[model samples]
Target: MMANPNYASLKELARAKRAQYGVTTEALNLIVVRKIYSDEGIRIDNWEFPRTIRAAYMSDDADPSVAINKTLPREPRLFSLVHELKHHYVDRPKIEQGQIKCGDYNENQTIEIGAEVFAAEFIYPETEFLERLQLLNIEPGQCSPEDVVRLKRECRACVSYQFLRKRLVRLGFAMPHAFDKIQFQKLEEQLYGPPIYKQKWFQRRRGRAQAK
Candidate 1:
């Protein structure tokens, strides 16, 4: 009768969706949330949403149509939708049950991050994205917001930071966290610069590396 607060519930929801729709989790994200929640008949209570940006919300009951806060960017919008779905199954009414306390969550809560990561990786496998980026000669150290956006546009990647971070992690690439990531900046700067020409350099070095 109560909703599950743990983000794991979302993962189960995601896994089930991927299996049913034949789409990767990332690709299935807010889109899936939008579809399933709507089919269930849940609608967002608009008055509860913030003013600046249209925040995504879900109605707890079977009235499944998702009320997307239109102003939120596509990435966060999708994440919020999933977060709201989590609320539908886990958060609401529990305040009375003492499962989750009121005002316990801020806009920047970490569980939202987890849900987004769940959605992103399912869409773009870290290994697959990195290998493809490398194959495109786009190094991780050489990535930026623009590069991220470009990659998402070109590869249809889910637009979330940790998703990109995971890909770089798998590729043994490090991102500068304290300040702006220079790698991405470099890529942005070089966008119109003379191209990088790597003529079979790896091919010549591959045999020795592979043999060792």
Candidate 2:
């Protein structure tokens, strides 16, 4: 996979943003993004959208805006909002005149990669996140999913395990094969519990089905 071209700069930006919010520890809250939106004259709105689409951006040049799908869970909503904000702050030159829609920006493999990159780096600053990983004391190619989950909890960040695993490899703390998402997920369940997002979504679907 091609690396994010803007990785270094985005990491710095995320760190600065985190510091600006007085985020000494714990998760970098979505409210920090909202503060940027306020400063940049951007507006936020919630709208219903298809399951595949998580967020959208409309750049008026003077006052840009973002819309997050109302149905998304808390983690996805925060990440999606950051992704759209990336479009607003970094990729404004690339965005088309009026609007652009993002369907799970991470999976959109073309022009939107920069936004996804920004969100990942912003959510997990490289140096601080790596320091957290170091405390795990796990060797290369030996990391289990439970370790990543614990680190996520420690960081108080809502990022996915897959992202953490990739960061591990990216930073050379772990080898490429060390982070298997599927195996990690299984170990995660055994250690922690079933994924909350899937559990909630499944319950909601079942309720809707019963209602119908």
User: Which number leads on TM-score?
Assistant: 2
Cα lDDT tens digits, model 2, 1-212, are 66655666666766676666665435466676677678778899998888977888876645577887899876677788887777777766555442333333444565376666677777766666767767877565566556676776676677766667777676665677766535765776777778775588888988899999
TM-scores for every candidate against the unseen true structure? 0.53, 0.71
Lowest-sum lDDT 10-residue window in model 1 = 56-65
Q: How close is candidate 1 to the true structure, as a TM-score?
A: 0.53
Residue 34 of model 2: what lDDT?
A: 78
Stretches off by above 4 angstroms in model 2 are 1-5, 24-27, 96-111, 169-189, 193-212
Candidate 2 clashes between residue pairs 3 or more apart in a chain or in different chains: none
What is the per-residue lDDT of model 1 for residues 57-105, given as tens digits with 9 covering 90 to 100?
Answer: 3333433334555666666666566556555544456533545443344
Query: In model 1, what is the error at residue 114, expressed in angstroms?
Result: 3.3
